[model samples]
Target chain A: SQKIEQNSEALNIQEGKTATLTCNYTNYSPAYLQWYRQDPGRGPVFLLLIRENEKEKRKERLKVTFDTTLKQSLFHITASQPADSATYLCALDVRYGQNFVFGPGTRLSVLP
Target chain B: EAGVTQFPSHSVIEKGQTVTLRCDPISGHDNLYWYRRVMGKEIKFLLHFVKESKQDESGMPNNRFLAERTGGTYSTLKVQPAELEDSGVYFCASSQDTGSTDGYTFGSGTRLTVV
Candidate 1:
């Protein structure tokens, strides 16, 4: 069965440190991947997107890397702060544009 | 420009009752989509609409769920004879182009509870 998995456990990191989250999948080849941030009572907001041909995509303090050979994507938040604490989700563009599959998501908490 | 909007934000209904959820996409976005996440599960796609046309509905669970996009603007999802397992958060998303690259804008979602 095809599956997309992210660390279901909450990740805690010291303030100003780098927080890394991993997303792995099996039995599927996606053209691209996207990362999103979701806060309580709010919808997910798009953060970054990386294509299969791209090794890394970065914006400000956020970075995403996609390794199709490993079927994995890593999301990193640099200089993490309390405001960056939220559930992070990785999604695959299944069937190109028609549908999407999201990972269970990983919760990150930056401690002071 | 406003983002995608959904209403009501939350709904609580008894089993067998019918409920309608609405979604207003960003202006000029011809593509709209519906998705849901049950407890402890990943968000799953329900369907997609392109300017009042059903592009893909392979994710619709059963016949009890009916979705409509009126005048290629706002969309509605109706679940009749709801079941206990229908409890989940329904999300609406829209994009100007196919979501292969730029991500779609998402609504806050309507949390539905069936007792």
Candidate 2:
């Protein structure tokens, strides 16, 4: 079975600063990867997806990078705000999105 | 368009009791998936339903869990004689096709607590 790892420690940063979170996996590489934002008591909402062939993708202030060689992905929230405070999860999809194997998630807090 | 919707936002039941969680996927979606997250743990896949059939149920923990997607419209997950360890948040998600390029849409989830 594949295993996904993320920082368990909560990350605290000042609002307006950039927040970077990492996701790493072991075993075979996935066909694609996705990032999600989960608010307290709510399910994860889709943020972005990057295929193995894609090095980087950006949507507004959100950016995601995929480094298959390192078996890692980085999620960045630029110009972060208090609203960005939530648990961010990275999911690995194999066999053409059968679909997802999610990491434990890293809770980020943007302080005002 | 409405995203996935789960009934009974919260459920509290006693051990040895039964609880049923309902999930209605987005209209026209052919794939539905169920996942659960225990307190302080990672979210784990339970099963996947393609239309009215179970495509993969390898993640279902034990025989105590039953899932159905009759008519391929809505789905139900029943935990029979729920145990204390069954306490967790159940999430339902849906995608239009097998290869979900748009990503899956998840519901708010049903929080289940067994005492």
Candidate 3:
């Protein structure tokens, strides 16, 4: 069976600092990996997606790095703001399947 | 453009009852997906519909759940004789194109509490 894991503990950092989150998976070779931001009482909002062949992807202050060799992906949010506090989720597209498997997600809090 | 929308933002039902959840995907989106997240658990995929056809339903837990996408515009998920473990938040998402790299737009979600 395939499994995805993220930092279970909530990450707290000061505003304007860089926040790094990790996502690791086992027993699956995904075609693409994606990251999403979810706030309390709301659905997840997509952030970035990186293919297995791609090394890194960026959007605004967010950067995502995919290392297929280690079966891990790293998501970074630079100059984090108080408004950036939320749960970050990592999802992977199952090759040839319609469903995407998601990790438990890591909660981030940026204090001003 | 409007994002995906789900009806009855919150629902409370008794065990063994039937509940139906509705999702209206963004207009012109060809791919619609259903996902659920239980308390303290990851969001898990339930099913996918592509233009009124069920592309994949492998994530459906059991025979008590049924999902339909009529005319490929809106979708419905019905759970009959819901169990205690069915309490969770259900989300609906859609993408404009199947092959594009664009991210999906998700609805606010419907929180189902099975008491």
Candidate 4:
């Protein structure tokens, strides 16, 4: 089975600073990786997706990078705000499977 | 458009009891998925339904868990003789197709507690 792991359980950073989160996987190389933000008492919302061939992708202040060679993906939020504080999850679809596998998620807290 | 919706926002059942969770996907979506996240654990895929057909259910933990998508509109996951380990937040998601670009829209999820 494919397994995914986030860089940390929780991360705390200042509002103006950038927050970086990592997702690592083992066993297979996914064609695309997705990032989602999950707020308390709610489901996750899609943030960004990066393809294996693409080194980086950006949506406003959010950026995601896929490093297949390193078997990892990094998610960054620039000029973070308190609103950005939430649990972020990384997910990948198995090439041979119908469902996606998700990492445990890293809870990020942006201090004001 | 309305997002996916799940029923019984929360459930509490005694061990060995039966519990059923329901989900209604967005209109016209062909792909509906069931996922669960145990306490302190990552969300895990449970099964996938494509227009009333079971595309894949390999993630289903055991025979005690049964899922049905009748009429290709709504889905129900019934767990008979539920165990403590079955307690988790069950989430339903849907998409027009399997394309990663479209992304999947998720429901608020049903939190289940088995004691």
Residue ranges of candidate 3 with Cα displaced over 4 Å: none
User: Which candidate number would show the highest TM-score if scored against the true structure?
Assistant: 1
Give a tens-digit lDDT track for model 3, residues A16-102.
Answer: 999999999999898999899999999999999899999999999999999999999999999999999999999998743367889
Q: Give the TM-score (0 to 1) of chain B in model 3.
A: 0.97
Candidate 2 lDDT over B1-115, as tens digits, reads 9889999899999999999999999999999999999988889889999999999899999999999999999999999989999999999999998768789999999999999
User: Can you write out model 4's per-residue Cα lDDT over B1-115, one digit (the tens) per residue?
Assistant: 8889999999999999999999999999989999999998889999999899999998899999999999999999999999999999999999887855767899999999999
**DockQ values per model:** 0.79, 0.77, 0.70, 0.65
TM-score of 1: 0.98
lDDT (CA) for every model shown? 0.93, 0.93, 0.92, 0.91
| N/CA/C clash count, model 4 | 0
lDDT of 1 by residue, A1-112 (tens): 9999996668999999999999999987988899999998888899998888999999999999999999999999999999999999999987677888999999999999
**Candidate order, TM-score descending:** 1, 3, 2, 4
In model 4 chain B, which range of ten residues has the least summed lDDT? Answer: B95-104
TM-score of 4: 0.96
Q: What is the DockQ of candidate 3?
A: 0.70
- DockQ of model 4, rounded to 2 decimals: 0.65
DockQ of predicted candidate 2: 0.77
